[model samples]
Target: MIDLDKVAHDYGGGALLSDITLRLEPGSFHFLTGPSGAGKTTFLKLCYAELVPTAGTVRLFGRDLREMRRDDVANTRRRIGVVHQDCQFLDHLTIAENVALPLAVSDRDPGAQADNLSELLDWVGLSAQARARPPELSGGERQRAALARAVMMDPEIVLADEPTGNVDWEMSLRLLQLLVELNRMGKSIVIATHDLNLIRAAKAQIAARVLRIKDRHLQLAGADL
Candidate 1:
């Protein structure tokens, strides 16, 4: 569903990523692991078309990112869901409202989707907190809510950055199970996390390719994983 061909990215300084070629096939799962400042987040941005590569090309669904118009980019983004490291949410909105924002923005009728929304909240184990505001949620609740928001649009690919970063081990595993369930339903998944143990746990449930970015390059992870 996404392809990056020898893609390299740079800011005003030097390159953050180099020769990072990858293809995320349909219904596949991948874990992106690397040290801090190793460009794991940057790679996710490239995959989701948030940042254009300075050198090579990033193609989403066979279309080159650099060639897409502003509106085109926005439309393409509808097919990809991103759970950021910070998990930004509208504090003014309730957890259910925040999770349903994507459908609302897509011009979907909220009344028609109310039942699905409730089921989704229940799926993430946040049914009781649906009416609660984001600030009232625990760290794990926020993360699960974020995941709910990301996948509400039924996106073909889901990109999560440090999904287990803030939660305890138990919560992390719970979130991981939710993701694995999504993958089983045929959504391509790419999660950028430093927690190798989480990746190991996920492997027990589904087939996932472990990838690492080191020395400015993206490569298949070694057996250490």
Candidate 2:
């Protein structure tokens, strides 16, 4: 669904990522691991067209990102869901409303799909907390809610950045299982995380390829991982 060829990105400094080529095929699962400031987040941004690469080409679906218009980029992004490190939500909005924000902003009526929203909350074990505000939720609850929101549109691909960063081990496992379920349902999944233990744990439950960033390049993680 995402294709990059010799992709390189820079932000006024030297290149953050360079000579990276990757193809994220449909229904494939991948774990992206690297130390801090290793451009894992920047790589994810390129996948979804949030940032245009300084060099080379990034293709979303079949079209080159640089060739897509603003509306085209926006429409294309609807097919890709992103779970940011910070689960930013409007505190005034209820959990259900927050989760349905994607539909709302896309000119779709959230109330029209109320049943699906309910089921999604239930799937994330947030049915009872649907009426609560963001601040009222615990770390795990917030993360789960973020997951629910990310998949609100049934996106074809899900990119999660440090999804378990703020949660406990038990909660991290819970989130991993939820992501695994998404993968089973045929969603392409890329989780950018630094937690090796979490990657090891996921390897036992799913056929996932681990990719590591080193010296501005992407490489397949060795069996030692």
Quick one: best lDDT, which candidate? 2
Give the Cα error of residue 189 in candidate 1, in Å.
0.6
CA lDDT for candidate 1? 0.93
Error of 2 at 146 (Å): 0.8
Native-referenced Cα lDDT, model 2: 0.94
CA shift of 50, model 2, Å: 1.3
Q: Which ten residues in a row have the lowest lDDT in candidate 2?
A: 107-116
User: Which consecutive 10 residues in model 1 have the weakest lDDT in total?
Assistant: 104-113
**What is the clash count for each candidate, in the order shown?**
0, 0
Instruction: Assess every candidate by TM-score.
Output: 0.97, 0.97
Please, what are the lDDT tens digits per residue for candidate 1 over residues 75-122? Answer: 888899899877899999999999998888886787887888999999
Q: lDDT of each prediction vs. the true structure?
A: 0.93, 0.94
Q: Residue 53's C-alpha lDDT in candidate 2? A: 99
